[model samples]
Target: MKKILLPTDFSENSWNAITYALQLFKNEECTFFLLNTFAPAVYQVEYLLVMPQPDETLNVYKESSLRNLEMLKERMQTEFSNPKHSIETISIFNTLVHQINEEIQDKSIDYIIMGTKGATGAREILFGSNTVFVLKKVKCPIIAVPETFTYESPHEILFPTDYGINYQDEHIQPLLNLTGNNVARINILHVDKGRGLTEYQERNKQQLESYFKHSAYLFHSVQNESVQEAIANFQLKVRVNLLVMLNNKHSFFENLFFKSTINQIGFHLNIPFFVIPTKLGKK
Candidate 1:
């Protein structure tokens, strides 16, 4: 069974992401973990040194968190009743990233699906504060669902890579599982900056080519525009259903969204983004 970890703040945005994940893996048997983390509004040093959890504020937060998790589970059961999907709820007084990492081990989670932000937040921000922190701290594969994105079959996937990091089997496993399950075609786009691939990059490219040998994919190289512009134009031209990238430091993924000619987030990023954490490579 597939174990999918869903961290929710009980907001519509988080609910949006949960709904998308359910529909995305509707056919496959999955156990979804609905988790909500809470911390006291204020922590007193005396309380921390003495009692781990206080009586008043901590109790209030715990009750609220538990209530919200139960409600979310009920909502999921009522709205999306699928024999293949079973959901479990968790309410913990911990930080988001720490809770997620713990659950990844406790439940053997496969994917962490979450919204980019709460409510209709500014699209200028690529990810919410929690999400960006989680991306940096968590090594598990995660899917960031935009606030207003409607669920769609990920038939066409757009993968933007600079081929900077060495390829690893663990890094590619999630992509392989997803594409293999959906029988989707991958469109690999390489943004040309008037320079050729370095020897290391070429090696990584060859490895990627080998990995996709039995799959249907097209490699496109485009130039004369910024990487962000290139991505938006490609999405416009192809109507891609998903956009994927690795959070590899010092790579294109690190700076992909910083500068754009439009100066705003596009539906290009609105498409469900599959982010593979870079540090997930072999220990």
Candidate 2:
């Protein structure tokens, strides 16, 4: 069964993602884990010294979280009736990024479906904060659904890579799984850094080409811009239905996503972004 982990703050944006996931995987038997992470509203060092029982203060918050989860589950069931799918809800008191990392490992989660607002106004300073954090740290594929993005079959997937990180079968498998035997086009985009490809980079690209030999795929190289700009421009030119990236630090994915100010980044991706963890690339 495909295991999907969805984190919700119970916002309408999150609900849109949850609904999208159900429809995306309607044909397959799947297990959905709805997760919520909460931290205390306030914390003081002096209070910790004087008040020994922190659990007492957290009890109320925990209770409220459980109630919210129950309500969310009921609403989802009523809206999307899939007999082959089972839904489970979990609430934990911890940081969102840490809890997500732990749960992915413990539950063997297959994909993480999240909603992204894409940094609005002051929020642009920290672009895709939670989504970026999990993208960097989690050990699974993450499908970031843009807020209010209606679901559609991914007929064209735009995947941007540098060939810096070695391509692994497991890392690419998720995309293949989503595409199945459908005649979907996989556009492998590589940004030329003016220095041209090293022998190692060329060989890695070849290996990647070999891996997707059976699928209808193309490799294109573009020059004279930042990796993010190249990708955004390519997406507009190709009219892609999905964006896929392998999250690796020091690579274009990290530079465009983690290192840049959220507002400055121009991907403004309206389609689903499939972020595959770098560790999953390990053989």
Candidate 3:
């Protein structure tokens, strides 16, 4: 069984993500951990100095968190009513990233499915700060569903890479599992920016081709265009429902996301982003 962690803040964006997850894995046996973390909005000097007993404010927040989690669980059962899926609720008073790290270790989480933006996220922003932090910090594979994105079978997946890192079975298992289950076609895209692929990159590309020989995959390349622009151009040609990328520090993925603001990068993702981290810790 797959262990998937879902973090919610009781927002429509979050609900949309949860709905997507349930539908994506409706036929499979899976356990979903519904997590919500809360902390005081502001810290008072007295509150910080003394570790007081459960205060009224803390109690109120904790109670609300638990109530919302239970309600969410009930809603999932009512809507899906799937015997293959089991729901677990977790309510805690801690930072979102911190608690997520703990849960990943404690539960051996396989994946995390969450919204790109939170309750207070702006319209133009592609990802909220929390989402960005998790993508950078968490090692688990994460599927960031767009706020208004409804459920769609990922018949075609677009994977953009520079062929920098050697592909690993463990790191790419999630992608393989998704495609194996959905019978989806994987489009491997590489953007050529004046210079050609190095010998190392060429070897990596050959290895990837071998890896996907049994699967339905196509290797695509475009010249004189930025990675972001190439992605946009390819999407225009192919109807891709899911976007996959490996978060390698030396790869263009890092330069595209970590160095600049998500929205300002000129690529606004309407489809779900399936990001697989190369390893745990900061990207």
* Stretches of model 2 off by over 4 angstroms after superposition: 43-54, 122-126, 181-183, 260-263, 281-283
Q: Each prediction's TM-score against the native?
A: 0.88, 0.88, 0.92
Question: How many collisions between residues are there in candidate 1?
Answer: 0
Instruction: Find the 10 residues in a row with the least total lDDT in model 1.
Output: 258-267
Arrange candidates by lDDT, descending: 3, 1, 2
Instruction: Indicate the worst ten consecutive residues by lDDT in candidate 2.
Output: 118-127
lDDT of 3 at 135: 88
Clashes of 2: 1
> What lDDT would candidate 2 get against the real structure?
0.81
Candidate 3 global CA lDDT score: 0.86
Between candidates 2 and 3, the one scoring higher on lDDT is: 3
Query: How well is each residue in 16-96 modelled by candidate 2, as lDDT tens digits?
Result: 899989988888889999999867647554554465454776988788889999999999889998898999998987778
Compose the digit string of candidate 3's lDDT tens values, residues 1-283: 9889999999999999999999888888999999998777685445544653546768888899999999999999999899999999999877788789889989888889999853344444557788989988888899999897888999999999999988888667888878777879999999887689999999999888888888999989899888888889898998899999999878888888887566665457888999998885331
lDDT of each: 0.82, 0.81, 0.86
Stretch of 10 with least lDDT, candidate 3: 117-126
